[model samples]
Target: MASWLARHGIQPTVVERASALRLGGNGVDVRGDAVTVVERMGLLPRVRELATDVRGMQFVDATGRAVARIHTQDPASPEIMRGDLVALLRAATDVDVLLGDSIRALEQDDDGVHVTFEHSPARRFDPVVGADGMHSNVRRIAFGPEERFITFKDHYFAFADTDAALGEDRWVTMFNTPGKMAGIYRSGNHAQAKAYFMFRSAPLDYDHRDVAEHKRLVSEAFAGEAGWRTRQLLDSALTDPGFYFDALGQVRMNSWSDGRVVLLGDAAWCASPASGAGAELALVGAYRLAGELAAANGDHRVVFPRYDAAHRPLVNDKQQIGPNVRLKVPKTDGGRCVRDVVARLPLMKAMSAVERRAQARNARPLPDFTRAA
Candidate 1:
């Protein structure tokens, strides 16, 4: 997104609520239309260079017996770490990024939008776009309350770095119980490993911003687990500063824009984390949004609706189906068995091929902006 804007002579001021760039998150997939966007931005080579070499996934029983395997080299898919992609995007732009600052309020009119920041001074832009993630303050100010948009999918997940000696490099080993799952991901360098845990749960009443409370909840839930590497990972994860926890939820909104105020990325439509499309969607969506605005000569009245129309179909297609929580974290032992069995079937291969074809068919080629001059 920053790349597209800078190429078009639109200078953007980036405000990040964090004190510095975040270096957390699991690997993310970049396929279909998103791959095209990255190539267009001239970051394809860089992205490939930094790609995470995750080999495959291995499902195991409590006794540590391997049950099923899914190679990461599956022809229909490709993946990279979230941090690598963010680094590439950040390096592509010359925008002035303001860290430790957040927008407190937004007021927009037909002419422009005025924004007040939590620490920085007030500023106005010709347009305001909220590219913030699921818990977007921009969405709240422009649209209604969050309850109207967030749909919880009855699960909670946590992940963090661990110190245990996981056997191999570049493979994710998973162990499943009735309603919970624990896994260890070994990265290419082997300098770091990640511990992941998830379980079925109804929506719980808690403060979303409370990290300490989140850690407490995760520790309490997995306190009784034994063997198969669960206790070691859990103990290490709780003490790690990079630990993250959140409810598996999706964001659904009827419209993505209002006047000069618009939304891009997860702020508008998040198909949920399990869909593995958040980073791809954000990167691709930002590219298209900026392209549309540039093509329309920065006249958002002409650009916003078109951008929404062009992108909403993809979002609808991906999210209209139920959340993918069941596929990522199976709820029951029977469910896990069923998932493993189905994964090895020829029908699964066919379904993956068909889905890729559908995505390709729905993709709209980005315009050649080099000739815009």
Candidate 2:
């Protein structure tokens, strides 16, 4: 967002609450039109070089037995670690960034937005955007509390750095019990492995920033659940400071902008990580938002509406998980067994072919920003 805005004659100041750009994150996927956004920025080669070379996914039994497999040959969508992608984006943009600081308050008028920072001096700008993640502070201050928009999917998920010995190289090995799923993602490019855990339950009550409490919650949720190296993964991740845990949810808002303040990425429309479209939505949303703002001479009233119209269709489509949810978290032993059987059947291939065709038909070509540029 900073880069695109700057390229189009807008001075952007990026405020990050983190002391620095965090380099620790799980693999993030660049699918569909997000590839165009990267290529247009001349970072496609860099992204591909750092891409996690995951062969595909494999469903396994508790006894380390592979029951079914999916080998993807699709190059249009590649997975790269979230931190590496963020690094690439940071390198692409030349903007003034204030670290360890965030917006304390925002007062937007017809002319501009008056802002106060947590650790920086007060200032005003023509627009202020809350591109923060799902539980965005900006969203809370500007739009209201998070519970109004965050619809929990009745599941909590966690991913953290773990021992690579837990999984075989090049394949994401997953195991499922009723109401829960656990997996290890083995990226050949990176020596360290990532542990993924998800369990279906009522909404959890815990502070979002409390890592220790989050670990305890995860361990408790998976307690007594045996097999598939669950004990070891939990043990390792509980001590690892990089543990990530949160409820699986999506942010649905009728509007992306309020006066001169607006939202972007997961803050505005989080389809959840399960959709594998978070990065795509953020990339395309940022590109379109900046383009609209630039085209309108920074007049957000016109820019926000145009941006919404151009982007919502893609988001609405990507938000649909459909059968993917069943494939991820089977609610019963019978469901898991049936999925295994379906994977071995010819119907799996037919579904894959149909999905590929739909993808081709719904290809969202990036608007020719050359004219807008």
Candidate 3:
């Protein structure tokens, strides 16, 4: 997104709450139209170079026996650690990024948007875009309280990177019990493995940014699981410095803009991580939002609505495909068994192919902004 804007002579100012660009997280898949977006940004080769080379994912039983497998080769999508992608995007653009600072408040007028940062002096931009993620400060100041637009899916998940010796290489090994899941994701990079745990629960009351509280919640939820290599993963995750926890939720807004304030990525309409489209949506949406702004010659009143209209159908379709909690991290032992059995069937392969094709068909290519030159 920054590259697109810079190429068009617009210098963007990026503010991040974190002290620096985050350099760790679970891997993210870049597939279909998203691959096109990266290619257009001229980052595809670099992205691929940093991609995670997990050969497949295996569903395991309580006894740690592999019950089924889904090979990455069957449906090829470039998977890179989220951090690597963020770094790539950051390196590609010359935007002024403010780290360890965030928007405290946003006030807009007919002429521009005024923003006050928590650690920086007040400033104004002709437009203010909230690309800050699901819990967006910019969105709240511009669009009202988050509870009105966020929907919880009654589940919580946590992940952290740990020493790679905890799991095997070239595969993501997952195990399930009734209403809970525990797993280890092994990347080709032997430096680390990711510990993941998820359970069905009503949204817990806690501070969103409190790491200790987040660890406590995850520890409490997965404390007594008795099988499938849960103990070690739990121990490592609880102590890991990079542990992360959040509810499985969706952000749905009636519209994504007000005055000169607009939103992109998870801030505007998160289809949820379960959709496997969050990164794709972020990349594609950012591109289109910037393109629309340029196309409208800086008139956000004309551009923001167009951005929303152009992106909504894709968002709606992916979200309506339903909560994929069960698919990625099945709850019941019986459900896991069923999933394993189905995955081994010929129909599963066919269905996966069909689904990929459908997603590609549904995606409209982002406009070529260079053409508008």
Candidate 4:
């Protein structure tokens, strides 16, 4: 967003709560319109160079034998580690970024918005955009309480760094027991592997920022499982200082803007990680929002609704995750067995191919924002 706006003669100030760019996360897919977005930014070559090159997902038995494997390689959709993509985006964007500080208050008038920061002095800007993630501080301050927007998806998940040697090369090895799954994501191109865990549960009460509590919940969920590297992965993940934990949830909003304050990325409409569309949505949505603003000469009223209209359909489509979560963490042993049997059949591959073809046929061409600029 900052990059696009700067190209159109609009200077954007980015305020971040983190001390620096967060460069650690699970792999994210860059496909469809997001590919066009990266190409426009002149970062496509570098992005392709850093692709994860993972082949597929493999379901493993408790005895560490592969029960079923699903090939997921797609030439059009390159999967890259989240940290690599973040680094590339940071290097591509040229703007003033105020790290370690965040918005404290916002007051809008006809002229502009008066802003107060956590550690910086009060200043005013023409408009404020919230690109913060699902638990957006900007959303809470401007839109209201989070419960009004966030819908819990009956699950919790965690991921952290783990020993690469523990997992197979270029495969996501998963072991499921009832409503829980423990897995290792070993990217063929990266030295570090990530331990992934997900379990079905009612929403738990806890502070989102409390790392210790997150670790405790994850530990308790997988403590009984002592097979197929689960115990080892759990220990390694819990020991990692940068462990990530959160509820699998989505954000739904009637509108993406409230006066001069607007939301984007996960702050506006998050389809959750299960959808495998976070990076794609963020890239395409940011490009569209920035393009709309440029076309309207930074007029929030003119651009906000247009941006919302242009981007909502894609967001709505991605939010329908269908069988993604269930496919990963089956609710019962019988379901797991059925999933394995179905996965082993050629029908799964055929269905996936059909879905991809239909998507390609229906996909609208991405707009050329440079022409507008």
Candidate 5:
């Protein structure tokens, strides 16, 4: 968002709640039009350098035998660690990003917006966009409460930094049990590893900000569940301080804009991790949002609608659960076995063909904002 805005005449002040950039996350992929957007931004080469060249995903059993392997070799797509990507993006932009502060309240009128912050003095801006992510403070203050938009996907997921050697280089190793899955991903580009845990559950009642509560929930859920290195992964999760836990959820809303304040990226339409399109959506959304605003000559009212019309289709399509979630976390043992069997069969080839076509169709044509604006 910052990068695109600065390319035009507008300079946006990025206000981050974290004291510093929290550079810890799982690998994120850029596919289709999103790859084009980064190319336009002139960061394509840098992205490729840091890309986690994961050979494939391997489903394993308790005895460490490979049930199946899906070789993820797409010349057009490359998955990069989220932290490294963000750092690169930050370096690319010259915008003033204020850290350790957030909007406390917002008031909008015919002219502009009045914003009060938790730490900084109250100020106003002509167009105040909430790129604040899924649990967006800007959305809460301007649009409505969060519960109105957030739809939980009957599951929970977490990832943490770990030195737990997955023993497999350039492969994501996953073990499935009834209603749960635990995985270890090792990148050939990086020495450090990551641990991922997911499970089927009803809406969990816990504080979003409390890491202890989230950790407790994960620990209790996989307390005795046995499978390939589940015990070791759980132990690693317990010891890691940089753990991330959240419900698998998507943000569905009627409209993304409210008066002069608008939402961008996950704050507006989070398709969740299951979609494998969060980073893609975010990059494309940011590019379009800034582009529309520039095209409209900084008119929030006109730009907001234009941005909505251009971006929502791709967002809607990606929100569907489809094969990505089911293929990874089958709810029952028999279902998991079926998945394993199918993954190893010729049927897997057909599924990949279908996915390729869908991705092509979903890759919407991004307006050349650099030229058009």
Candidate 6:
């Protein structure tokens, strides 16, 4: 967002809660319009160079034998490690960033917003954008509580660094038992592997900011599992300091703006990791937001609504992740069997091809926001 705004002669001050840039996460896909976003940023070549190169998913049995496999490679969509993408974006952006500081209060009037921060001196900006993740601090201050927007999707998941040798090369090997799934993502281009775990569950009580609590939740969820390298993966993941665990949830909002304050990316509409569209939604939404602001000559009233109207369709589309979740962690043994059978069939690949073509035909051309101003 800072990079896009800077391109349009707008200087943006980035406030980050963490002391340093966060460069740890699982693989994120950059496809469709997001590919254009990166291309415009002059990072497409580098992104491709750092791509995960994962071929497909391999479903395994109890003894760690591959039972079925699905080819998911697509030239149109390239998967890159989240940390690599973040590093590329950071290098591309030239802006002042206030690290280890957070907004304490936001008092908005007709002219601008009055801001107070936790560590830095208070400063006012004409418009404040919340690009924070699902539990956005700006949204809580400017709008209402998180309960009004966040919808839990009946599951929780965790992922962390693991041994590369645990799984087959160039494939995400998954082992499932009814509602639970234990998997290893072995990126063809990277030496480090990632362990993924997910299970069906009702909303559990835990602090989002507490890493110890997160580890415990994940451990408890996979405690009894001993099949197909589950114990090995779990033990490795639990020890990693960069382990990430979160509820499979989505952020839905009627509007993304409130006066001079507006939201973008996961703050406005997080379709969750299950959608495999976080990077896509964020890149496109930020470009549109900054472009609209530039076109309106920094007029929040004009830019906010335009930005919301332009990006909502893509968010709506990505938030439909029901099928994705079911595919990963089936509800029953029969369902898993059916999924494995379907995955092994050529029809699944053909259907995916058909779906991609249909999406391409239906998708509106991404606007050339560079010329909008």
Question: Among these predicted structures, which one has the highest lDDT?
Answer: 4
Q: State the lDDT of candidate 6 residue by residue for 224-332, as single tens digits.
A: 8998999999998989999999999999999999999999999999999999999999999998889888988999989898888777877887787747888899999
**Model 2 reaches what TM-score against the true structure?**
0.96
Candidate 4 residue-wise lDDT, 295-358, digit = tens: 8888999999988988887888889888899999999999999999988999888987786677
lDDT tens string, model 3, 61-175? Answer: 7787788887764234688889889889888888898999989988888888789999999999999988878888888888888898889988888999766786778898888
Candidate 4 has an lDDT of 0.92
Q: Which of the predicted structures, 1 or 6, would earn the higher lDDT when compared with the native?
A: 6
TM-score for all models, in order of appearance: 0.94, 0.96, 0.95, 0.98, 0.97, 0.97
Q: Tell me, what's the RMSD of every candidate? A: 1.9, 1.5, 1.6, 1.1, 1.3, 1.2
lDDT of each: 0.79, 0.87, 0.82, 0.92, 0.88, 0.91
Cα-lDDT of candidate 2: 0.87
Tell me how far the alpha carbon of residue 322 in candidate 2 is from the true structure, in angstroms, after superposition.
1.3
- Reference-based lDDT, residue 212, model 1: 90
In model 6, where do residues sit more than 4 Å from their true spots? none
Using TM-score, rank the candidates from best to worst: 4, 6, 5, 2, 3, 1
> Per-residue lDDT of 213-233 in model 5, one digit per residue for the tens?
989999999988876788888
- Candidate 1: residue pairs that collide: none
Error of 6 at 146 (Å): 0.6
Higher-lDDT candidate of 1 and 2: 2
User: 262, model 6: CA deviation in Å?
Assistant: 0.7
Worst 10 residues of 6 by lDDT: 355-364
Clashing pairs in 6: none
lDDT of 1 by residue, 145-175 (tens): 8899889977888898887385357788888
Q: What ranges in model 1 sit over 4 Å off?
A: 74-78, 320-323
